[model samples]
Target: MPGGGAGARRRGRPRKDEPALTERVVLDAGVRLLARDGLDAVTMRGLAAELGVRAASLYRYVRNKDELLDALADEQFAGIDLTRYVQDDWRAALTAMATALRRHLLARRDAARLIAGRFTTGPHSLRNIEALLTVLRGAGLSDHDAAFAAYTCVTSLFGFVAAEQNRLSAEVAAGMAPREYLDRLAGRLRAMPADRYPNVVALAGELTAPDLAARFDFAMARLLAGIDALVAAGEPR
Candidate 1:
């Protein structure tokens, strides 16, 4: 019994070698739970359990579920590549930012779901926002238009990514291939009588095309074109 201390081991207590729980550790566990299970599975109690800690301990780092979600949303912004944001070309800068944001959101499960509901002001989020505003201002946008463009870009990203995720999830749950699912959708649209739904019948294939990248680029091109027109018009501040 020289090295053994069997009697000293207590139930439900951390081992002497256990790492201390910090906010970052808690957030990491929360993200893992979200990715492995989904958004609804990331409650305080569940996260505590995932970390093998008491539920009350999590409160020391994150007071509640809302704070956790906000922190997580901010954390997702950490992965964006700000270096690629071109300063001289506002359109290029914005397009790069938007594309990077979309990629980051879609990389994690339910990332957009939580981010859409939370307004994060963490350092990473603020840095990205600052970059966006700078580009807008450099493009000769008024303060109001800069604000509007920033909000519009972020909201559009959230909406489009959320829709893409939902569609992918639905396809997975239905046990169908992506192309098969789109084909089925196209068929359903084409089935409607041409007399009643001429446009829909005529463009069913185009409507249900699975080219999300092309569609997203087209949408952003149109939005940026409108903003470009506003800049050209020299709208009053």
Candidate 2:
């Protein structure tokens, strides 16, 4: 009767206050270590210590460090709404995807760096790509052009987010203020002899001008817009 359906007993529910066990804990601990100290600190042992469990216990949930890292990478994409996102107007859809990606990466600034360059073919990433492909096709792009456009936009988003995250570090934040840094650079350029460098000295402010956020937005948006236009006007078959 112990293992039989006739008189088998169901497993008891855990007490309300009882701590449940799962890969969630493992992954959450990995994320915390990753966010606090970057990817290098996220060994299985380190994650176990962070979770207050034996290092060997992690094997029950994750097979190895690679699996944990994959889980951590997948966590970043957990915030995206693929169904809603892939359903919008092509340009609007692309913008939404980029914005969502930026927000997700910005939240766990360290996590962004870890997962950016790894072979990113997880379900979420593929779904996003498939959506991008579909949108490009809808906008009258050839297969090659669609793929290239998707690569451009996705990579640009990742690069922008990574650069922003790097600069947003506490050290950079506490060090030279961006505006002051730009002002100092402006001064340096102004000090240059106009006779030697007329063009640079004449446009000192233009050279050192720092409209970082707006400038970044303008650049990313323009790049995507350009790709959209080009893909929409794909070469003849």
Candidate 3:
């Protein structure tokens, strides 16, 4: 009789011995799905299946797909290390922070797209912004200028990563190596009439270089230089 009761219990609805699903668990599953299959595949139904739960169960943790994505972005932001970038020299600190952000974004597929247009007030995101503001203010920027600096840095990061990802995807789709693609582009640029586009023709090699790192570094330097000039002029603060 005791054996029969144990068997009945097993045959009956399985006990929920596993821990209850939390927002973290749902977001983790969503991130894995996003990384493996891209953003289109990271749906509530898909995530539920990944977690061996029903789609409706996900609603208990997140209201909808948008919220789920926000949770995912928050998780990604939580991983960024701003400690090394929070130093006396704001220029160095900002550079480090931007570099770190770009590196982290590129680590996951479609990650740049995920966080690009969305505004997140999550703790981690807020913390990162606070760190940036602190660094800029320390460098003699007023509150308004510091906020603007932080915004500029983040917008540049998102745009750069988004463009980089798109270019990589295009290269893969076209089945062309990065250098080969750039060479082809250079050739096209050189074909333009030298009289009409002399500068473009002359700078084709530099313009079409495949060195993304150099391009990013140059852009960052220019941005910081503009800020330094403004600071020197005692414009805002």
Candidate 4:
């Protein structure tokens, strides 16, 4: 009877040799699921299975899926190397940061979508914001301008990356090469009534520019130029 009860206990409970289920372990597993599969694959049960634990166990760390997603977004931010974006020139530093962030978001499946609309309070997220603010302030921006610039840059990054990912996925889903899709789109734009839409008919190709990276660079350059003008104007007296 004693041996039978011990065997039953062992069957129902986790083995002593199994790894402990900590927040970091759960978050790491979630990252793996998100990267390997996608945002949809990061359910509590799925993550628990990935970590060899029960679904209920994950609640010890995260309250729900939304909390898990917020944590995962923070994890992605944590993975970014802020030092890599550091530069003596503010424009160069911000450019590097934006470029690095785009690449980072694209590296994982649905990473950009996962981060969109979530305001994480994790240390990594805070550090990233602090770093951006520091860069803007160092560039001689007024406090108001610095805050505005930081918000603008972050929102632009997320929106741009999300759109980029969605476009790529759409192309893949439609079974068309990206260039082919762009060409088709350009054709449609060019066929518009010239009198009604002169610019759309005239510059369809440019409108559907194939080089998103170059476009992103152009955008950042324009943003920096505007900031530079503000700096030249000197804080509003």
Measured with C-alpha atoms, the lDDT of residue 62 in candidate 3 is: 71
lDDT of each: 0.79, 0.69, 0.78, 0.79
The digit string of per-residue lDDT tens for model 4 on 60-111 reads 5666677788888888887786656666699889988888888988887788
**Residue by residue across 1-237, what tens digits does model 2's lDDT show?**
001132121222324443454656667777789888877798978986787666665565666677677777767776675556765477777777667777778888565676766555567656666776877677777777777777777777777777766754354468977667668777988899989999999899986666656766786679777877776567844
Candidate 2 has a TM-score of: 0.71
Clashing pairs in 2: none
Pairs of colliding residues, candidate 3: none
lDDT of 1 by residue, 108-130 (tens): 88888878856677888778788
- In TM-score terms, which candidate is top? 1
Q: TM-score for every candidate vs. truth?
A: 0.86, 0.71, 0.82, 0.82
User: Candidate 1, residue 37: CA error in Å?
Assistant: 1.9
Cα distance off (Å), candidate 4, residue 53: 4.2
lDDT of 1: 0.79
Q: On a 0 to 100 scale, what is the lDDT of residue 53 in model 1? A: 75
Question: Model 1, stretches more than 4 Å misplaced?
Answer: 1-19, 168-171
Candidate 3 lowest-lDDT run of ten: 1-10
